[model samples]
Every structure is written in C-alpha cells, then in structure tokens.
Target: MEQNYLAPAETMQIHELLNFKTICMTSSKMMEGVVFDQELKTLFEKDVRQSITAINDLQVLLGKAPKLR
Candidate 1:
C-alpha cells in the first residue's frame, strides 16, 4: 500500500491554494461575461465554496492563537 504522509490540515492548505488560483482564473474569465461557459461558471462556484471553507477553518485556527489583548 502506498502511504500518504500528508496530514489532513496540510492537505486542506493545498486545496485552499488550488482553490484560490482557480478563483483568480475564473475572476478573469468573469470579466468577459459573454465568453464564459457553463464549465467556467461551475469551476467558479466550486472555488468560492472552497475559499469560504478555507477562510472559516483559518478563522477557527487563529482563534486558538495568542492575542495581544
């Protein structure tokens, strides 16, 4: 069996980065409204979801971090 060494948190970070990149690409595509296809729209929607999930996770993680206050 091939072992996967990456932790779930690290995998999530990679996914977040890929999602971010996709969002950037789709945002550019969005500028040319008439040229976008269903696939692009789908990709954009998925990217938004991933980005939101990533943000929420990060917020929770940061909540555990030491604060100045």
Candidate 2:
C-alpha cells in the first residue's frame, strides 16, 4: 500500500489544531461541571465528544508526517 506523507507545514498545522481541540475539550468538560442548565451541559458533552473524534482524526493525519531528524 502506498502511503502519503504530510509536508512539514501540514504537520505543524495539524499539531496546532490538536492543541486547540484539546484546550476546547478541556474547557467544555470543566464547564459541564458548573453549568446549571441541562441543555447547556448536554451541548458541552456533545462538543467534547466531537472534539475527541476530531483529535483522533488529526492524530491519524499527523502519523503520516515525515520524521524530522
């Protein structure tokens, strides 16, 4: 199977995205604990789940990046 490698720039972008998603997920999880409204809490939970999925996808793409010496 042929593998497509990511350019250095793309790799960096994915890293940044992973960091951002992680921050967002963490904040949402923290907020869920303090939120009084069930609807808002549910929304936060949904965001966290979606962030996890996105982070997984980004990691897969990052794996394709060439190793830097």
Whole-structure CA lDDT of model 2: 0.96
TM-score, candidate number 1: 0.50
Put down candidate 1 lDDT per residue, 1-69, tens digits, no spaces.
Answer: 854355656656766765675576567556446546778767666765665666566556544434345
Q: Pick the candidate with the highest TM-score.
A: 2
Per-residue lDDT tens digits of candidate 2, residues 1-69? Answer: 987999988999999999999999999999999999999999999999999999999999989999878
Worst 10 residues of 2 by lDDT: 1-10
Question: How much lDDT does each candidate structure score?
Answer: 0.60, 0.96
| Model 1 pairs whose backbones collide | none
Residue 63 of candidate 2: its Cα lDDT?
90
Model 2 sits at a Cα RMSD from the real structure of 1.2
* Top-lDDT structure, candidate number: 2
Q: If scored against the real structure, what TM-score would every candidate get?
A: 0.50, 0.93
